[model samples]
Target: MQYRTNPDYWNQWYPSDLISESFPGQFRNWFYSLLVMATVLDNSPPFKANFTYGTLVAEDGRAMHKSWGNSIEFNKAADKMGVDVMRWMYCNHKSENNLFFGYNRADEVRRQFLLPLWNAYKFLVNYAILDDWTPNGETLPILDNVLDTWIISRLNQVIDKVNTLIQNYDPFNATLVVESFINDLTNWYIRRSRRRFWRSEQDNDKKHAYAVLYHVITTLTRLLAPITPFVTEVMYQNLVHSNNPPQHIPFEGEGQGVMSHESVHHCEYPKADLSLVNDDILDQMSVARQVCSLGLSARNQAGLKVRQPLSKILVHMGDYHTELKPEFVQIILDELNVKQFEIVSKVESLVAYQVLPNNKILGPKFGRQFPKIRQALVVADHAEIVKKVNNGESISLDIDGESVVIYPDEVVIQTKPIEGLAVGADKHMTVGIDTIITDELATEGMSRELVRHIQALRKEAGFNIEDRITVYYQTDGDIANVFDTWTDYIKEETLTNELVSGTHAEEIFTKSVKIGKHEVMFGLKKI
Candidate 1:
């Protein structure tokens, strides 16, 4: 393989240092930079040094080779998950490290993240259309509601994080922040606001909710434009700017159109106005979230579901009382399906439990010490440990006659149960549960499960959101009684006009239908 032996052929083809870059190398550099720039433009601040650039060679210094079957072909990946999903994978991956591509990893991304996001987006579109939601030309007004302001602040925060990460070549963090936002939108924002979208026209709050969500969806579509081009474009066309004519946004350079044709790519990244992001507001919200998580986790552990309504939840706010007070109290009550959140100062009322490390502030310093430090800290008094840690005191330990100084950086302090409360805390957060589960709560849980099943049936039956329907019950006993109790819920959920008690009814061919347990049938007709 010596080039010196074949002087004529080798010399003509390969010139040292003067040879043009290989197609693969050129493509990689271009693609990598494009993604990096897109991310930078999404957030306002630049990423740190650790976030920038990655090396291509393996630790052994070998270039990845295709003949060795170690290289990934983009076209093959595109064929499998569609181009947008592939693009998302690339945008989300850690840019500071060489990415090892494989079929399995790609499949995992599609299944665990991409598909869920797509499904959520589809759900939003389906419901929005059904509700005949359209954003009135009014701009959003500043509001005192935490939900409203929190979402806007979060949107701006995402823009900042994404831009900084992208600009600094930290695609991993960028991707993570965006993914978090998507989860928030689907699970919290949309789920909590579903009733507003479905309410009657006379409800002004419904209109305001629609407007807020509309702004959010539209802004999200634009924000995601660079990462998942095709999907975002499709979403934008279907959801936002639907009345306008189609227009293409080019990837690079200066371009203009009759309208402001500044591609979302070229648009300035959004800046976070500090006035919008209130730490106190966020802390209160965290309390609400903690309470909700505890209740939900408790429900899951007890084999109870979210639809069940508890009579009350006692929140043991040892140190967090003032923080969790009136602000998020109502939100916690709604999220936990509890009638009230009784704030308790003592742990004596708690019944069931779980404990977790408070690792957020402590993990960075004490991660190296691990099990030994954790053990010692667990037995120590909470107030004493807190005082020492806050005062910057260091504890000395004798390990094999060698003095080891356990500074604040060498140990972690966490909360532990001494008495009554049913509690749980994880690395970053904590929660507590109520022990009692009532019969009415169980029935409500069953009702919720039924609603989920009916919704699934409707989707499977190809019923559109605007479809009006009637449900027929053919069963007796508990299930029948459950349906009877929640007839109005079923009607609202299925967009049904009626729910008949009878088993048999004349069917219309044009109508969509689904049959469930014990020959219960759901019939749908487009209004």
Candidate 2:
């Protein structure tokens, strides 16, 4: 990488007689200086050369110095997580920017990417073993469920984006895409599909769920293998090869076979499946998620907790509106714990309006008349103004028989929420929550809270997630009525086979639980 001009010039010029002629006292120093300059100018031999310069700094972009203690030892860093983690982090940084290395950054990689990936693999392996499932290389139908379609579409999109980013030498964004995908796979896909794996019978839907999960994990492992070899290798082995036999080489034109490869590093990179990538569904889902988010925000404003179900949520799609399908709206309803969802086409009935003169626009245009304009705005029928504004019209005024007109932009419009409703809105849409809680909703909420409390108690009691038990409870007041109303719900949610409400013998597992204003003595016995 280093380059220098012709060495022949140096040899010819530095012959013994010439150096002896000029090697006297100060003359020798003068001769050497000119000889150095001659090398620079001496391109007679036509040698090709280039040079580059930049400041050499430490990993944190600071000047490296032992005195400052900013210098990182290479072997020491490698010892922390091995060279693989450090290498991946290094490759993930943009080359044009300085990389600030720290243990926290490495921990983020482990937490955000590596740990989730490994945990997903472990979850699949453990559940597959419990269900006695093996990969027969069956091509599960994608249309089996909406969740299946959604996840497969997401995976294909990730594959497309990651491949393009890596191809363009942008590993930073590519790794970020992979990180985000891992999060969705763990939090949404697996979390939503857990019941399928937990079901006693291995039905067709359950098998389809398993197949989709296996396909996603193995493909993601392969996708990430290049960046993180060791972790993905361990994942691939446990999730794939542990169950896939050696004789299963996979039939041609069938579903993707379980990878029989010994290590993930030896696998080929994944290619995007264009047919599985549905942008429309993704967009619709994105809008539905926003609605749910805004609805939750509205609930927070109303001082209503999620466990307390609301009667209805009214969504007003603003300028950038989206038509959400019924299924998407159902997701919003379930997430927000609302009995019904309504889409508002017009907000005149939903919102009260106030009009204020825009001083910035009117002040300069009608300097002395600005006060009159402000006065007119205050007394003007605000509802009429709102109607006109919504219709993209201007307001007119008459002072001393001289007519003046003010455009909508000359006024600021503010919305006032109707009484008893908590409203939250952005440019995208407005979400209003009817905060009134009926007796039935209250009972249902209390039932859900009881289920949560018992689940926590189950964990504290050292019982497994699938353990079945008998419930005993003693409560006074409305809590007993709530229990009576939601008995079946509580039983199903808590995996309880028997329910007793009157009294129970004192036992080590008995504990007092607070339900609303009353404290109830509850106990769980293994069935």
Q: Which candidate leads the pack in TM-score?
A: 2
TM-score of each: 0.67, 0.78
Q: Candidate 2: where is the Cα deviation over 4 Å?
A: 1-88, 198-201, 247-259, 320-322, 355-366, 372-413, 502-508
TM-score of 1: 0.67
Residue 470 of model 2, lDDT score: 85
Give per-residue CA lDDT, model 2, range 211-262, as digits (tens). Answer: 8887888788778777777777777777656656563533111245544777
Clash pairs for candidate 2: none
- Per-candidate Cα lDDT values, in order, are 0.59, 0.75
